[model samples]
Target: MVIPIFLPHLGCRDRCTYCHQGYITDVSGEDIKARIDAAFIHRAAPCDVGLFGGNIFGIEPAVLEKMFSFFEPYRDWVRAFRLSTKPVPLRDETIYLLKENKTDIIELGIPTFNDAILAGLNRAHTGQDLFDAYHRLQEEGFSVALQFMVGLPGENENDIENIIRNMVRLKPVYIRIYPLVVLKDTPLYTLYRTGQFRPTAFDDVLDCACRIYANAVKNGISVANVGLTDNELVRDMVAGGHYHPAYGFLVQSRIFIRAVEIVLKHLGYPKDITIILHNADIPLLIGHKKQNIMKFSRMGVTVKWVPSGNNRGHFEVRSQKGSAAGSVQDIYDQ
Candidate 1:
């Protein structure tokens, strides 16, 4: 379980082209303490406490220290202390302070590595800032996650490939991908209005995101997230772009389709085939609205998806003439 503590725009120095944090309701420090207290007092299981909504390090050291102190009494019950921040200069002392407070992971919102794209987004940090912060945090023995976005303004397929290559080189403990969404009162929205920037088509974005997800997972890096969260504020502010509550499912469904296609291609489109997958992946395999099943049907290929209580990613395909069992990598490699 994870308990999120939203410090909405609490330490923002500048706004990004997609953020509208000012419209979000604020949660006071007192309110945070009360929530934490209630979580521990009422809940029995261990839970991670996340400090989200803005850069935690950007807050004043004194106030941060005070906030960290609030978790001291419940330290034993806290499974993890995770926080997200922008790619900014981080002092060594601040790293040490986080360690002293038992912080577990630091997620950096790096978005994209392309300098031109970063500039277009008005992300006030250089690519070097990301490398510096990543190295510094790792050197301090803290797990770090590099957060990336899929459809930032000016980003393309080549940009996505480059970002994946760079992220693999960094080898962060976790990676998150947020497909861009044009929100109200942001620079991106202005650009959209002027026809200066166009959001990537949702299907195109889903395909691109699936490529990144497959490559990243194959590299042994955890793709912690695939899309943005849906909420009242997001719904109210979203003007366009890939904003879907079930975005992760959509990406996985695409992946499932690809994996199945690869297998079928290799097997010479047998008359009938049974694809055995883990039970948990049933919905993804069938796809949203049974799209995959229907697609196979339209191709005149008899496809059956069977669930087995086995390891995820481990699957088997059986046809009248042949049978094979392998993981996604096996099929993808073909």
Candidate 2:
């Protein structure tokens, strides 16, 4: 488990076009100490601590040192430290401080490798910066995770390919995929209001996210998360872009549906079939709102599912004519 301490926009020099951390997180930078204290109160087990919601590397070494000092008293309860930030301004001093403070993982937010898009988002860093930071962090014996965004302004299929290529090459410890969401009062919101930045089709964005996620899993990289966590504040602030409360579920269900479609095709589109899968994956197979079931109905295939002790992601489809067993991994392998 990880205890999150949100320092929203604390170390950021300038807000990105889509950032409005105040709406995404309730805790302010000023509440760091109090938040930390509250989180550790009545703690019964050591847990990892996550410093989130700011460009941690952008903070001065002195400020970072002091900020880490807040956790000194509860250091015994912290198994390790992790933080997320933009992958630039990674000063050697900051690196040393992070290592000295027992920070084991650094999650770099690389929205896209497209230079033009990066500049348009006011990220103030390029793809080269991420490569530099990633290499440096790895050399320092730090495990790295990546956070990627989809459906950004100016993003296209090429950009998505770039993301997959880099992710496969770097092979981070894990990854989180987020579809961009325009928040209220942000620069991106202004663009949306003026009709200058219309988001891509929702299904298109979801499909692209599935491709990224599938690539990550196929490459043996764990997907730490997919999509943003829904909250009242975020729900209230969303102006446009791909935002959904069950966004992650939608991605997983899409992958399941795709895998089933491939298996059915290989079986010559059997009219009726029963899928035996691990009980844990029933939700994924059924999908949100039973959409997958309805989709199968439209395709002239009758679907039935049975729970089994079969390993997760493993499914067997049976029909009168034939039987085939496959896993989600089959989707990427083909």
Candidate 3:
């Protein structure tokens, strides 16, 4: 479990077009210690304490020292510490400081690989900067996690594809996929008002996110998150774009349905089949409203889901007539 501390927009010199961090974050500067103390008091030892939301590394040196000092009391009990930062140059001293504080993970926001898109969003960093920071973090033995947002201004299918391919090559231990949301008072909202830009259609972004998620899974990279955290603040501020409360679950259900269809195709339209899946995948396979199962029923397919404790990805498709064949990985391999 993670105990997250939000810094909001703290080290971001320039705001991205879609960002409204001030509205999204719940914790403020005045209550940072109170929130931290409350979270730490309830959390048990050996859990991750994450510094989320802003560019932590970009914080002033004195303030960074103060923040680290705050965590000093919990150092003996905290299993690992993680922080999110922008994809910018890092000093050797920063690495030393993080290492000294026992920070195990560093997450970088690399939204997209296209330099043009990056500039349009005013991210103030380039793809090369991301690569440099990633390698430097790894060289210091820090586990890296990458964060990407889909449906950004001036992005296309090819742009997203390039990002996934490049990210796979980077091979970060974890990744996050956030679909673009046009928040109130952001530059992107102005663009929407002026008819200069439009957010990607919900279906299109969903399709793109599924592809990214599937590729990450196949490459052995864990997708830590697939959507923004839903809250009243976000709901009130949302101007437009893909903003589902259960967005990640929707994508997972889509992937599950696709996997089932692929297995059915391979089985030559078997009348009765038992799907052996991991115990944890029940919610995804069953879907938000049992949509996946309902889809199969509509297709005139008889489906039975059997839970398996050890199955992770190589699921067994067992025919009622005593034939078992095809795994989830087989669909991708073909």
- Cα TM-score per model: 0.91, 0.96, 0.88
- The candidate scoring highest on TM-score is 2
Model 3 spans with C-alpha error above 4 angstroms? 23-31, 42-46, 270-273, 308-310, 318-324, 331-334
At residue 5, candidate 3 shows an lDDT of: 82
Model 1 ranges with Cα > 4 A deviation? 22-41, 330-334
Positional deviation of 225 in candidate 3, in angstroms? 1.5
* Candidate scoring better on TM-score of 1 and 2: 2
lDDT of 1 at 275: 85
Residue 191 displacement in candidate 3 (angstroms): 1.7
> Between the candidate structures 1 and 3, which one is better when assessed by TM-score?
1
The lDDT-based order of candidates, best leading, equals: 2, 3, 1
Candidate 2 to native Cα RMSD, angstroms? 2.0
lDDT of all predictions: 0.80, 0.91, 0.80
Query: lDDT tens digits, residues 1-334, model 3?
Result: 7778877877666778888888434334446666667777865667888898777777766666667777666776678789999976477667888888888999999899999999998989999999999998998899999999888877887887887888889999999999999888999899988889888789888878888888888888899989989999999999888899999999887877787777777667678878888888777777878888887788887778788864665466678455454444443321
Model 1 root mean square deviation, Cα atoms: 2.5
Q: After TM-score superposition, what is the CA distance of residue 240 in candidate 2 from its true location, in Å?
A: 1.1
**Model 2 lDDT per residue over 1-334, tens place:** 9999888887788779999988434334447778889989989999999999999998878888888888988989999999999997989999999999899999999999999999999999999999999999999999999999999988988999999999999999999999999999999999999999999999999988998988888899999999888899999999889999999999999999899888899999999999999998999998999999999999999988899999988899999769999788777431
Pairs of colliding residues, candidate 3: none
